[model samples]
Target: MSAAPSPAPPRETRQREVISRLLQSAEGPLGVPELHARALNELPRLGVATVYRTLKLLQEQGAAHIVTLDGENLYEASGRGHHHHFSCRQCGRVYTLNTCPVALPAGTVYPGGFVVEAHEVTLYGLCPACAPR
Candidate 1:
């Protein structure tokens, strides 16, 4: 006989738990592979594709946020207040700053017809640990 369909996690509960874990262990944002790797330790049967799908869903639903630059996307739990990123080019590690310093002041002039909803700032350079030896 065919196996019955598996039950889906309740969205609010699953998203909240995911966010809590991501925040508690946050070294920075996590990419899909990293998220999957971490999830494997918790939800062993979770697939990489599922991770990507969940991330996308979270981003769309404003439950999680992503910081992308140079073709890679990094993810973190949302509702932590505004946040920004710092990337260590030497070691290729990504980190989050407590406060964002690079963004322009709100109400700064922009093209008349353009409506800016959100902006992501990614700083590239060596992190303290990755400084030249």
Candidate 2:
């Protein structure tokens, strides 16, 4: 049987537009503070709460992805799945890795009969610009 359709997302607002623009223009995941700061350029009234709420709504709608780095919750635009990310230690820049390095042999199973559904990998290092001259 076909699955039931999901409810439509909430109506768009100026804050949502600002948050969406920031997320889409970002090269990697962004935290609430960063999103709010950048959004202020176009939306001076943008607040942290609005950014958080918009991010939550976007995530629930599968329009964004939540990434956790060092216990920090970050959000990024969706559609870049099945890959990994790279973070520069020197400059604190995050880059997308087009390759996925996870491979499991056939018949592989968890110790408690658990199933592997998905995984994410984050690499840390210096970017080309940040590398030693």
Candidate 3:
């Protein structure tokens, strides 16, 4: 008897949905709990572990990113290749800047033989609403 074909990959579907909700929500970055809760709205049985796993997959495929700032791990959409980020301390909000100010002359900063694949730029401070006078 012939062996039955393997089932389709569920991780891909879950990962796509995860990335879609993240971009549509546009909440800068979200923690696992927050992301998982949101995913549950569409997928009632979504689990936190699945959320983490899918997020890792998304990061590996360059579809999303995880930012660890001030002891918090947050996830965000990353289809624009790579970019910088700004997060508010008081309000606990996050923002993605259009570009980074820090720049290095090509072939100077990086090691002679090493290749620079990607970089993460992050800044943390009080946002406009949370700033103190």
Candidate 4:
């Protein structure tokens, strides 16, 4: 007989709810520090360790994912679907690019006969506010 799937994680606590809402509503992915700071507004006594644990749980549950930009890891809700990111060097901020520019078809074969299963693209440049007119 096939084994049954494991039970889902316990229902979210008040703290996890705050963290999850922040991730879902953020304009872009947020690093731990940013997420913690924002969460503190609603949950003044929230601990950094709790934030770390909650993020880990979210990732394990496929409710969130990490985006690494300029060596910093950021978190965003998984419901965003297929998309990429852009990093502003001057502002040190990462933004989500809702529209994908890549047109590669699935199962595309490379020059060496390697098939493309997935891809990630990150664009780096100055954001509008940082760009010189």
Give the candidate number with the greatest TM-score: 4
TM-score, prediction 1: 0.69
Model 4 agreement with the true structure over 1-133: per-residue lDDT tens digits: 9999998768869998999999998878999999999999999999999999999999988999988877788999998878888889898878889988898767999998999998888889998889999
- How would you encode candidate 2's per-residue C-alpha lDDT over 2-67 as one tens digit per residue? 989987768988888778877887878887877788999998877778787888899888889888
Encode model 1's per-residue lDDT on 1-133: one tens digit a residue.
Answer: 9999987755565634664476447878877787777777777777777677777777776777766767887788787777778889888888887787766665566788665566667789999998977
The window of 10 residues in a row where model 2 has the poorest summed lDDT is: 100-109
- RMSD in angstroms, all models? 7.0, 4.3, 4.7, 2.6
How much does candidate 3 score in TM-score?
0.65
Clash totals for all candidate models = 0, 0, 0, 0
* Candidate with the larger TM-score of 2 and 4: 4
Computed on alpha carbons, the lDDT of every model, listed in order, comes to 0.73, 0.82, 0.72, 0.91
The CA lDDT at 122 in model 2 is 92
Candidate 4 similarity to native, TM-score: 0.88
Q: Return the top candidate by lDDT.
A: 4
Total residue pair clashes for candidate 3: 0
Off by over 4 Å in 2: 1-9, 104-115
Decide which is better by lDDT, 2 or 4.
Answer: 4
Q: After superposition, how far is residue 126 of candidate 3 from its true place, in Å?
A: 1.8
Cα deviation of 83, candidate 4, in Å: 0.6
* Model 3 lDDT per residue over 1-133, tens place: 9999987655448546755666556747777877777777778887777787787877876777767877888888876544677888787778777776667434444556765555667788987788887
